[model samples]
Target: MGLLRKAARAMLSLSLATRPAVADTEIDKHSVDVAATARAFAQAAPLAIGDSYDYAPGVQGEADAEGRIGDTDFKLRLFGAWDAQDEERRYADIRQASLHWRHDRLSLGAGVGTFFWGVSESINVVNVLNQADLRQAVDSKEKMGQTFVSLGLRFGNGELSLFYLPTFREREFPERPAFGLPVSQRALFETPDKGGDIALRGLFYAGDLEAGLGYFKGTRRSPLLIRRSPTATEWTPFYIETENLLLDALYLLHEATLKLEAKTGRELDQGFFAANVGIEYPVYSLPGGIQELSLIAEYLVDDRGERAETLGQNDLFIGLRTSFGDIGNSSFRGVVSYDFDSQGNYLDLGLEHRLSDYFRFETRALVFLNAGRDDNWLYPVRNEDFIEFKLHYSF
Candidate 1:
């Protein structure tokens, strides 16, 4: 309690000391902006209803406040959402609430924040800082906010960052009736103590080539399921379950990135290494520079071979992205992924267009093909193909 109180006092003092200076500078510069952004949507399927499908509806609201005071910058964003699918779907969270102080070669940040540190189109193997909010999206693009203190220093042509995460958050999953795991046998998370994780990363860029190396030691954001009993079968006939089935495994991760957006990483004690080697290059441009098309290809591999869940042990992902550089700022992206070991494949398509300055429209579809019992993680969701549309309004 004493340490926590001291930390709180320090944070409060830091904020108070810089508040007035920032306000005066902003008033002089006449550059202050505060606003709110929000999105609401309803999701359904075009096919007839089935025992495994449910109509999911949700809405998200957020407010952001940002300003600069002299050499310090502060931003606070509050996010909340509600989903009609289940009771656990409704949540209120701090998306980003942080103060950033910068010097000539040093930068410091504190409070809850979010950051991504990977270079992959289909998956992010090196980004392990924040847990995914899977209920919002299964693509792993959306992440929950993490509270931490960060320090970054620039030396020569490289930058080094150190982070201290004071708490750990678990990944969010959708209800069983949805496309993910069943809710009947929910996972039991092993919560961690305060200040349970530390991370370090160094990044360097040279000409057209860039590279990064990172190390993380802490409780895993993803949980591993363990059977409570050898013969328990209430969760599913294929697998056993226990009362305390969710186990949070502690791990050390070492990752590296190279040019062409290649990423490789290994988890200590996991006995496997994973790699995503890919390149994203623009194919051509349309006439008058109104549109552009880009090609993407990546080979994914896991040393665990065919026994891995979630990610296929050996796979290929090919995608195309088209951007309409018009007033509406429309874009379309699609990807097809195939697993060599199980002969399973999936397709993902997404489209987005702006209706007005304050409104936008988006749609996405996920389709599974040739998925069978041999597939590790995709077999349960093979029959859950669906399309989703959303209209977003921001101001």
Candidate 2:
């Protein structure tokens, strides 16, 4: 691996230093990024799930490169991860590979890429362009790439964009049953395998406020779990045809920021609504050389309430972020989420520090509280609290 990286760097430098002049096409600029991480979890596997080690080890790597030449630009990214305990967790993905062209107010792009479309931090109900990569994490924030052709028209204060996606990626899961329920490997889709989707969005910017309006019609990224047969003990993912209207906005107010994201959609032939509203307020110059402290709070609401298919239904999330302003760039974040209906709570704590110029260290802890009731979504994993540590190297 070291030899390959050295060769790649030498070739890139040689190509840039010894390029031939061509038809007035300016060889603009290029950049490359590579990183790797070693991680471990200090948690024991539940006997009900399977036999596993008291500690789990994992590794991850990613590389990205981008360049711009004249009126066209291109980007590529690759990522892979492997864990010792689960075969399903060992996989690689092409997160992005695309070419984009722009002239005046019009722009076009083609290829596979990942897209993000929400302003809230806790949860984003409007981000549906790419499929979720659940094997990597349970937050549903990670995503797989999608093949698409996109066009955009820029105006005075806004841009109108349209996307035509030609492919769909299925969700991934662990071999062991999640929450002690059996899950099948096969997935069902309402549309044909190749039947793609379409989306349109308009973004506007004015002073301290940023807002967007979006519409999507196609396969639902979030699937409904259904029994494969009447008597079967296993469940399969079922992706249904759906349509959604999305709204997201951010407004700056002095030392604080206001964020709002809301979506109303039709999935599984039923209408649903969800929203997240939050605020971020920062206080500078605390005691004991503390550089800053940020307070984050958000409220999550879903019309389905306790029967929602996912977590964060009628819950409140509060977080505190501390920056030390030290040479190692140390920071810490702590969060607590409380379920209003179930009276359950979740706690998360994270700390990060740069060990050296090329190395970084991070640690995180997750705990569940008052989740003994089976009706609560977190009940199955209530005893699955764990702490994780990671070391990252980048160049």
List candidate 1 segments past 4 Å from native. Answer: 1-53, 176-195, 231-270, 285-290, 305-310, 325-328
Local accuracy of candidate 2 as per-residue lDDT tens digits, 1-395: 33233324433443343342335344343333333433344455454235654556778777777765444666777888787777777888778766667778988776668899988767787888988887765567789877777889999999999998866676777642254455667888777753368999999999999999999998877777777778866667787787889999999999899999888887757889988999999987577758778899999888855335455778899998887855428999998988887788878888998877778778877777668474446775565566777787877
Clashing pairs in 2: none
Per model, how many backbone clashes are there? 4, 0
Model 2, global lDDT: 0.73
The number of residue pairs in model 1 that clash at the backbone is 4
The sequence of per-residue lDDT tens digits that candidate 1 reaches over residues 193-285 is 434588888887665455677777666565454445776432321121111111111111222222222333334334446666776777553
Question: TM per model?
Answer: 0.78, 0.85
What TM-score, to 2 decimals, does candidate 2 have?
Answer: 0.85
Pick the TM-score winner. 2
